[model samples]
Target: MVLNMQPMRTDSTIPRIVICGNLEFASAECESLFKGVAEVLVMNSLSSADLIEGMQPGGRYEGAVGILRQWNGFSHMQRAFIEALPSSVKYISSLGAGYDMIDIDACKEKGIIVAHTPGVGNDATAVTALYLIISALRRFSVAERQLRAGLFDASRVTQGRRDPTVRTLAILGLGGIGLRLAELVHAFPMRVVYHNRRPFVGAPEWCEYYGPGRLDEMLAMADVLSVHVPLRKDTVGLVDEAMIRKLKKGAVLINTARGKVVDEEAMIRALEDEHLSAVGLDVFPDEPTVNPRLLELPNATLLPHLGSISSDAQKLMEVRGLTNLRDLVLGLNVADLVPECR
Candidate 1:
């Protein structure tokens, strides 16, 4: 599946960039941008073995200076893959906002600069979070399930439905996605409070800010808790049993962030015990395979991680990712380089 866009040239003066996956939305744009600047090689295979082999001494990607890969092109880009990359490979651009699948520490060790598509999918993902919040709060998933099973009793389905009016929404991270969701829920007139490492400057007056040390206080006041932080070493299992216990009883929980950020088992226990009135999730601890226990819960609303799959978002992400690679090869500053690299 590896197709060299151009034949190997004897002259090594021109830099080479290897595209590790297909760009369904931005192929033409990629060619136009890279024209005459760098030799482009398209690696269509999704197999890690194929990529590793291509990076070998005498392989097709022996002299590749940059790599651009699709978000789901292969499995984790960990230490092994970093070690396999040719010394000429100095930069990598991945088409997604969250680069948790890429081992930043490993990339650092190899002196590789990594960039990701950020901000382009914020609106799409924020809208998805808003959808989950409303659906969970209103118990729409339960209603839909009952209707599909021919058990459509209005009284039964409306038992635990809650309205967003006057409810307090506590956001765990007030980054771009979190702020967008905050603005969205303002339509419902829900009171918004966010916990961040520091106060976000120029925040709307209606949106209250809580310092990092006041997370428990914010959780205690929230009727709805939405998580929007990235998955990092310190954030994994951040919303564990103890943290979830601090939330107001019967609080609705929504997570569009990485699943491992919250302890799934602990959340499930809270739901079973009625401590959590409802739960909504777009990402799971083990993606593509959700826990059966969550599926069985009447109050649990779930999605298959389709937060940023809109056509517009897809095209923007592809273009930004490719631009990052192009800029790196051209010796320009990379705007979307991962924070760890900067």
Candidate 2:
């Protein structure tokens, strides 16, 4: 396929932008940063066909339409969405990272420019996951809750002869964030081991590689277990009751990946029964709201999905999305343009 490698030109007429998914967030970025370059259409829900049908009236977007969406869990309608769009929709930019949910090959077949914001949230999310691992291992959530509920001597329950600095850590799915976390974990001289779908090339010397079979074995030996895998059919619910049961007694669990990849109910039970020491979750099966049982338990450190919230990351995301869309409209070359599924 021929790739558009030209640069962007703002001299063209005002383009139209259709904001799908969360409009409030996109509008905030566009109104504040994008200015008068494009016509913005903010809609909460527009069916795949409806979106394309709307653009067909003029046979194409007024100039070029930029389609923006968030990392909402996977949707099968993606193929339909991409196929329906007239070759006129020049660019599809995901607001956050992880474009796995979108069909890239389909976009590529149509020469639609596809780009995702990567490395933007790497540091923020890596730091968040590391914090979660530490909090879970030390049972910080339990103490915080106990003290807030007018209970004294919360330390007895939280700091009961536990030292995370001395325990081993096993990371599942060593992507950018996982590697960053590994670097941080090494500072404490902790034993760090990881299992990835494929062996990572040029991994840091501090990380010991383990094949898939070793994953179960590693879990049984680790005191802190962190998950960093992307959500896919093969990986969804990768860890269930059986896997949790394999972990060392009082082992801590941390998940920064998609919530659906884990069985939330099972995790809660493991924490309550003390089969697992504690859990720090930054994402949930249902986001913006989570299971009430998790909130009621002190053994869980639940973050409101702020793993990617940082000034630098947010600005980078805005700039990448804006630049990608601008380049596609101007028929310029965009870096990291993902194609759609065949």
Candidate 3:
């Protein structure tokens, strides 16, 4: 995709916003959406360190939008960027659902605003999670491999399928995407249970809610466990060796959540030991690079984080991020402000 940076023009007293990270984040279409509302700056040519240093302490940067795919986790460079945000920059809107890379605390402490594209990607991401659930539980990958290799014709083969309608699905996180997953999972043949920080007040009656130190119970009850939590201080490696061992024997593990949420080595051990029947993953601990061992495993189904790649979802996300920036610029309440920023 051709990336362009429009010359800074002040045709009116419109807001001046900065767009950072990869050229893909500041797509031409994304920049076009800001027309007549804000002056968009695409800082693709600048390195992260340069981005941080380019900001003058008193510059008139009213807002910033980030679509950093390579920034899988927050680092000192990101912290430095957050610290260097000009005083006029009231809000920093990120393109994706997770804002773990953006320093919420720094923004809150500085009285600057930060927002995320939360629900825009829900439908597509939830569908991807459900796809993993079915593919992992039913051994679709292995069956496909054998069929393509002519093993299916060479010998009689049989594998048991764990019907979703017949088993209970435990959703590990009940946030936007998780709730969407629950909405779809409830319609399937299986029962649904979810664990969140607190019991969701208005969840559908058919869906069960578990909270306040009930992860183990959730793990035990799950015939198919799908993780949906974010990566945070409390969630990094949350599912460790001990936790992996808590699964019901011959159960499927589905993680569309952050890969760091599950202990990769422990998970591999569990798979080898037959503690976990099969595993499906979208996000990995590292992006564009996965554990080589996982690729070699026959019981694992891997996806290259195709959760929110849908054009519809991506455009909506860009609109949402721009909306937050525009709203904050007008001194109005940002509809999609992160809780910490609010």
**Candidate 2, residues 197-316: lDDT per residue as tens digits?**
677887887688888778788888888889988877787788898888999988888998889888888888998898987889999987767999988887788898889877667666
Best of the two (1, 3) by lDDT = 1
Q: Report the lDDT of model 3 for residue 35.
A: 69
| Per-residue error (Å), model 3, residue 234 | 1.1
TM-score per candidate, chains pooled: 0.94, 0.79, 0.85
Better of 2 and 3 by TM-score: 3
Model 3 Cα lDDT, one tens digit per residue, 112-216: 777777788999999999998888877788788878898885323446556677689888877788788888877776788888888877778777888868878
Instruction: Please provide, for model 1 over 98-132, each residue's C-alpha lDDT reduced to its tens digit, 9 standing for 90 to 100.
Output: 99999889899999999999888899999998888
Ranking by lDDT: 1, 3, 2
The Cα local distance difference test for each model comes to: 0.87, 0.72, 0.73
TM-score of 2: 0.79
Candidate 2 worst ten-residue window by lDDT: 1-10
Residue 240 of candidate 2: its Cα lDDT?
A: 90
Give me the runs in candidate 3 sitting further than 4 Å from their true place: 12-14, 21-36, 53-77, 86-88, 147-156
